[model samples]
Target: MNKKYVLFAILPFALSACQSFPTHLKKNEAMIVETQSPDLLQTLSDYTWIYQSSEKLPPIVLDLDAQKRIFIKTGCNNLMGAWQFDGKQINTAPLAATQMLCPPEFMAQEHTAFQFFNQAQLNASINISNPVHPLLTLENKAGQKITFKGEIKPEAKYKSTGEVVFLEVSPNKKPCPTDNTQQCLQVKQVKYDKQGIQTQIDQSWQVLPVEIQGYQHNTKQSKIIRVKRFNTKPQTATPEYAYIYDMTIEEEVAPQK
Candidate 1:
């Protein structure tokens, strides 16, 4: 192991039986990138790490969410597991994964990912000097090293979990709010109750001059989607509140009668 990498993990008794990693490891934004010594667990949860092994595979996304569950996206099947970091190495429970059949290349890469994250007592190193683009390296006992680069998550960037709101987007576009020549998505607020039943929907459509992250509108079909809205910080000088696409509720094409 490299002497420069200082990993301060808990003892055996400290890491009691639990499906997830220790909650103490999961801290707020303050413990992340703003100190002389950054917390490893906090940084892992706040940033999305991209696998840097092969350029052929659609970048594998390895991230540890606030809940301490390990999530790996191989662009084929998703690999999930709960991990624990002892003072020496990392050990994860038997991984849970989706059984999706993909191309040979993707499957081949997925195999390597599954082996690494599932392996016992793996050595890991992280460097968060550049908050925007941190680097993580994991080495197996066989002397093979896998690297990943980090990108700050939206929730981390905005400093909040943000409000989850639903919207029904129209199939057609309205005139853009600022530019008359451009077109924009016409949307209305959709409300759902605790039972997941429709409660209310805004009757009138409004011009959405801004774009929602991870969303792509189809002119032929109207769709309802769930999204998170966050107040943009003054430093970014972005919109009043930034919208990120969460999931699609429903969609359909109207009969042109």
Candidate 2:
């Protein structure tokens, strides 16, 4: 062999025989570190999480209850399911969703979200270094990650179970019976059976003086809305029934009187 080739061949063997070479090579081999587990059930319960980033659709809302129930609002459709959290892993059951035609973008976003939660196993982590602004991250075996930021809900803040009710709001805001100067929404309670069939609808409309927490009224359209009613103890000046809009069922213009 040529002198140069012999030197090169021996150099690699010599370096491999040195102890420092093993250490140097070990440094380059990547090591996979496992993530620490946190109290997932406690951290995830009761709060509502909104997706921080989305393509062209509205932010998705996620809610986890203490009863292991999961609720999701995917811009257009409402989904319900159950979730289980072991010490280190999380799993979700089959989710049922409302069948409503939505914009193509919204539907695509919903499909992506549904697939994320419907995964067989997911690893969850919560970063609470900043208590005021906590971050939740979920990772799957496929290396896909989804992050969410949460806000405490009104009922969750108070640690109370809210009464859920549905209301149909008239398209036009009529004058309040007590105060003609104040315009109010004409609303009526709608009742449903265990099977979710509409059992009763109050024909008489009542004037809703106060606005619903999450509802945005459209001046041109009526809405069938679901609301959560919370009663504050040691009643303050606030209304007896504090309403938070859950979802809108129908959007149509009410007949003008």
Most accurate candidate by lDDT: 1
Candidate 2: C-alpha lDDT:
0.67
**How many clashes in each structure?**
0, 0
- Return the TM-score for each candidate structure: 0.73, 0.64
Tell me the whole-model lDDT of each prediction, alpha carbons only. Answer: 0.73, 0.67
Residue-level lDDT of model 2, residues 99-199, one tens digit each, is 88999988888888788875346787878886655777888778898788878777766556788887888877889777899898889887766556667
Best by TM-score: 1
Pairs clashing in candidate 1? Answer: none
